[model samples]
Target: MAQALGAQTIYEIKQALHRCPVQLSRLVIHKTQDYALELVDYKVLVRLNPLCKALYLLFLQHPEGIVLKEMSLYKTELWNIYLQVCRHNDLKSAEKSVAELCNPLSNSIHEKIARIKSSFETLTDKHIAEYYIIAGARGKAKKIALPPNLIVWQ
Candidate 1:
């Protein structure tokens, strides 16, 4: 099936379909050589409305707990789709569309983090340490003064 629909042909089809503003399809096919998918089998998978909605909800509920690596992977995949969209449309328009789709979720995730911070007073130290880890910091660990009511998890 893949051989019958070559990557270039698939990409061209996606470009044409994308140009039709009324079309509802979310799938975007691109040349495999253009982007690398770390996991999942496909060059690009522009999730449909339902899956995207579900993911947004999950992200809202567990923003800090979500794995950063997985989010990075998903962003990379989406960026590839943005590149494909740009091929058929103007680059600025495609970038704006992708940003419009992604920015809200990004803001929501940040808001969730802020909510978590506000809910726990003594969590400041632990949360800061976690931020360092997420930022890929290296060096000796800094001592954190935890309040008596605060609980630290190893």
Candidate 2:
């Protein structure tokens, strides 16, 4: 009866718009109104503190990866980024924090990156979180596994 009333309206099927395939590995870190890391496919949002977020942003800007042992070389650049995003005007304290972040001590940056990775891991599963983390071989430079094209600055 419905088909007779209107052929166009007769039982039809359509794909779900929401089900369109998303790049499961694609990730974005929002630095505009909020500080959060997102997994496009899974719609996962991981909010990060200003310090951690700044550190993560530094990695995003360096595609070739930065050597953990040579972090001191990036002190000025890292500090600049931190000052811009840390949401505070206290140069004295921000300077000190940046110093510690780029410190020569092997454990300093290692521990910080680990914390950021662990934070994301807690937001979703460890496997997905790994893609958002700074990872590399023992002696190789460390970088976020995400491709540059996939990153969204804002």
Candidate 3:
């Protein structure tokens, strides 16, 4: 009977769906007063240094955009986040680190940004990684191009 055939087809469709290896997992950033960023997908937790974490979070906060020339302006705010994640008892010793971050002439900030990009790539493909990177065209403002919907802010 057609009813029996339809029931068989339904069972087959359920089996097919169950056999397909597809599971969706979201990327989440766990927040803490310590100011560290823990990038978590289903299987990986990417860890970053305090300075790198601070810079990455700063960009994430600003979806609009930020340029290299403007890196100096974020120094105070960057330090505030960095200080919380830094493993130092005194802020004096960490002053040099913040100084370098604020220096427009320094490439250290660029290096940190690259590390953040690579960290994501290491966990996923370039396609997924690209979503999380600070992307911008030439002569344009760079941004942490991830969609606001994809990011779970904690």
Candidate 4:
């Protein structure tokens, strides 16, 4: 779908056409392949760096969303995911990276999330990207807007 027209206009057109079910690419997370991200409908792979992939996987797992200030609570989970996704052999270095990412005082996590957003933006229109990206207002829980039914864990 070309986004040359405004999102509202697109919505109105879809409404007029009576498109009951909006078509959205399903996001597949291959857990056996270290949580690889893919758009099954589009036949596209969403590549993210190790840390970013870890963060994204975490967000996907918790559709309820994760508040930034409370990221420390999920540090262990993130670290475990990072370990699976990262190719480095240095476990200590990986642990340190997770520590930095989960630190409330550090902006590392935000940077990784920004990269994740950029990756999705390049792959799809903003309206559709919103479904796959992690987003939320300040002081609130950030989450992927994609519905659970559209997500597959293999």
Candidate 5:
């Protein structure tokens, strides 16, 4: 029946079915002036590699995000050392905790921290901070307010 209606494959049919429930709900909500799609919460899981996990975890501990691209330029040596520490850790959990403990001073994780802060700042406008906070909080939903304003570059 799905194919007859122009869904090409079984995967397409499944995809359509998966999305139908949401679409139907949205359609019903559209009837109400107060309801909007932005209010709906949808989640997708991403599996991160060990290194990114370590980096992401470290960034979570900092109130400001890290700036990877700029940090790579200004603090190559410190970044290399941190990368080495990430490689030495056995488990992702240990890597995450150790990375936080290893760099308590903002100057210690300076470049990496800047990069992460920058990334989060960039995402603030798009409602991506919720995802970051969700990931950082390890799936614990915590209420977070967006920063006053993201720093804009010229």
Candidate 6:
């Protein structure tokens, strides 16, 4: 009789778990509208510093990944993205910011990437955040691990 009750309790617990709603977060990048980042399922906007946002968007665009040393190749693209995301109209300052990021001698790129990682980790679980972060080993290409289907670019 005790065994029967335990089995019934287990079945009830499973049923309860099945009934609970699971939230699947989808990241939506608003490309045409100021490069805004949004969690579609949660209806929340993720705020990243202008430069960090530009870096994140660049990674999102390149699923194949990007090497740190090769950032100079993307200086133009990054600068363009930064221009749209940044509220200020200081073109010279924005250009300088992108130049520093592409300069291997400076640690600006690393700092921006760290800030971008922190932004996502704060919004969700570490495992989930991994999908939204720029990560890779030294001397290898870094990329966001999120599935392409989960990312929506507008």
Best by TM-score: 4
Error of 5 at 128 (Å): 7.8
The estimated TM-scores of all candidates read 0.22, 0.75, 0.75, 0.85, 0.24, 0.81
lDDT score for residue 50 of model 4:
92
lDDT of 4 by residue, 1-60 (tens): 324333357667665544434578999999888789999998899999999999999999
- Whole-model lDDT values for every prediction: 0.34, 0.73, 0.73, 0.88, 0.37, 0.85
For candidate 3, write residues 1-154 as lDDT tens digits. Answer: 4353343676776666555454334557676645434445556676777778778878877889888778888888888877766777777868788888779889887788888888878877666677778878866799976668767777
List model 6 lDDT by residue over 7-73, tens digit each.
Answer: 3576776666545554558899887778889989878888898889989988888999999999999
Model 3 residue 136 lDDT?
84
Q: Give the range of the ten consecutive residues with the poorest summed lDDT in model 5.
A: 22-31
Worst 10 residues of 3 by lDDT: 17-26
Could you give me the TM-score of model 1 versus the true structure? 0.22
Runs in model 3 with CA error above 4 Å?
Answer: 1-25, 33-41
* Superposed model 4: Cα runs more than 4 Å off: 1-22
- Cα lDDT of model 3 overall? 0.73
Of candidate 1, the 10-residue stretch with the lowest lDDT total is 35-44
Off by over 4 Å in 1: 1-74, 105-154
Error of 4 at 63 (Å): 0.9
> Largest lDDT belongs to which candidate?
4
